[model samples]
Target: VNQNEHTPTGTIREFVALSVRSINFVMNAFAWIIALALLALALYLLYRWGTANYDYFEQRRVPYVLPFSAYGRMLTGRLHPVDAAGEGYRVFPEERFSGFFVFRQPGYLIHDPELIKQITIKDFDHFVDHSFNISPELDPFLGRSLFFES
Candidate 1:
């Protein structure tokens, strides 16, 4: 046999190698497409969850203090909790209660002491469960606090 002549087995092996490379290329492309699609879906879902109840106050006709001002400021550590509460309180001084959000959870800030007493005393059981959340791993003390008792 001439050295330059291709044997049947050699030709088969070369063809198999080329086929594997093509399959790998296609699979890689498909994987990337799937990954990108998943990323986009996750982002969209997050956006939806973040703003799902943004119209809570508007629907209830309650005064809304733009959460981005006080809550957002507190989250970023740019404003103290007292300052944030003060700002929220000032926004609707006349309203008996106002709707706000602590990250996506709806909350009502009762401007009247009577309403606060009613919620804390008469309707205490109804309002026991709160949506505040904290990771135990991140903050053992606060995460395990009464805020998330329910």
Candidate 2:
């Protein structure tokens, strides 16, 4: 009896080894497919997040300007913040207030003094608490600002 001889036990062992290799190959392929699917899902979710509030002012029938072009200019230093603000005001000169976006966050450009007074004084309490959270430990200046006192 030689070790190289093809005995029944040796044949069975070889078959088992080949089956394991095939199973491993299939499992690796399945894992890669699942990983690619998850990556695609994450990208789609990011896109949804970026566009979530794009139609916010439009749906409410508010006078608004799309900020993407201006935002891009500002990011590249081609447009100054003051110039961007002026542009927003010029776009809706007759409106008392106009809407705009900073990415997906909505904001207002108030062109009327009375409305500004109402929001700053008469309705001060309502606007006191901002919708964003800041950690004092990370950003003490902003976290301790009057607007974010609470």
Candidate 2 residue-wise lDDT, 87-120, digit = tens? 6688888889988887788887889999988988
Tens digits of per-residue lDDT for model 1, 34-110 = 99999999999998888888888889888877877877778799989776655658888887888777677777778
Model 2 poorest 10 in a row by lDDT:
126-135
Which lDDT value does model 1 have at 104? 78
Steric clash pairs (candidate 1):
none
Candidate 2, residue 61: how far the Cα is off, in Å: 1.1
Q: Candidate 2 at 108: error in angstroms? A: 1.5
Q: After TM-score superposition, what is the CA distance of residue 20 in candidate 2 from its true location, in Å? A: 20
Q: What is the TM-score of each candidate against the true structure?
A: 0.55, 0.58
Q: Give the lDDT of residue 143 in candidate 2.
A: 85
| Candidate 1 accuracy as lDDT | 0.81
TM-score of 1: 0.55
Best by lDDT: 2
lDDT of each: 0.81, 0.85
